[model samples]
Target: MTKESPLKTLIGLAQDDVDTAAQRLGRLQRERGEAEAQLQALITYRDEYHARFTESARAGMAAGSVRNFQAFIDTLDAAIGQQQRMLEQADARLEAAKPEWRRQKQKLGSYEVLQARSEATEARKSARREQRDADEHAARVLRMRASNP
Candidate 1:
């Protein structure tokens, strides 16, 4: 088996880091999406409840019923505000994860570049050795011909 280059090992590790970062970024994005969906759902529910309350009031609701509706609507409004804050926090976390993932990707790319350059250098060296061997063999064959003749 060929010995592994140290650079190859470093590159592999860097790639793993990049993969981990990407996964984390994906998770963060999913969480952000979920939070946003929840926020939207809360907003929709609040709007629907408010509309129902308005309809009841127009249809001659009792004073007690109006107060109850107002109180419940106020509670829903508070919950919606809380959910909006949670969504904002999720967005912030997703934004923070993005730069770290990008940094990992850049690091992996740099390691890959080093590996490529190392391979190229080895190829050049091998080619030079092969050329030198061919030239020596040709000279030896000519010398033998001259001596035998």
Candidate 2:
């Protein structure tokens, strides 16, 4: 069995880094999407609740009921604001992950380029060796025929 070269080991390590970085970026994107979805849901619920509250106030509502409705709406506003902040934070994290992923991908690409060049050079050397062997065999055959004749 042939021993692995340092370049092969480096390529493996680079590939692992790229995979890990991509996973991290993907996870951050998922978290951002979930945060945005939750924010949208909260906004939709708040809008529907406010519409109902408006209709109830126009028809009739006791003082206590009005106060409770207003307070609940205020609470919903605060929660919506908090969710917006969370979504912003998730966006920031996702943005941060992108650079690392790009860096890892570039490193892997560099290693792959080196590997390709090395393989190409080795193939040329092998072809040269094969040509030399064939030439030597032909020369030996010619020498043997001359001696026999």
Q: Which candidate is the best by TM-score?
A: 2
List RMSD in Å for every model shown. 1.2, 0.9
Which tens-of-lDDT digit does each residue in 87-107 have in candidate 1?
889989999999999999999
Instruction: Provide the lDDT at 149 for model 2.
Output: 94
Q: For all candidates, what are the clash counts?
A: 0, 0
Q: TM per model?
A: 0.94, 0.97
The clash number for model 1 is 0
lDDT agreement with native, every candidate: 0.91, 0.96
For candidate 2, write residues 20-49 as lDDT tens digits: 999999999999999999999999999999
Best-performing candidate as measured by lDDT:
2
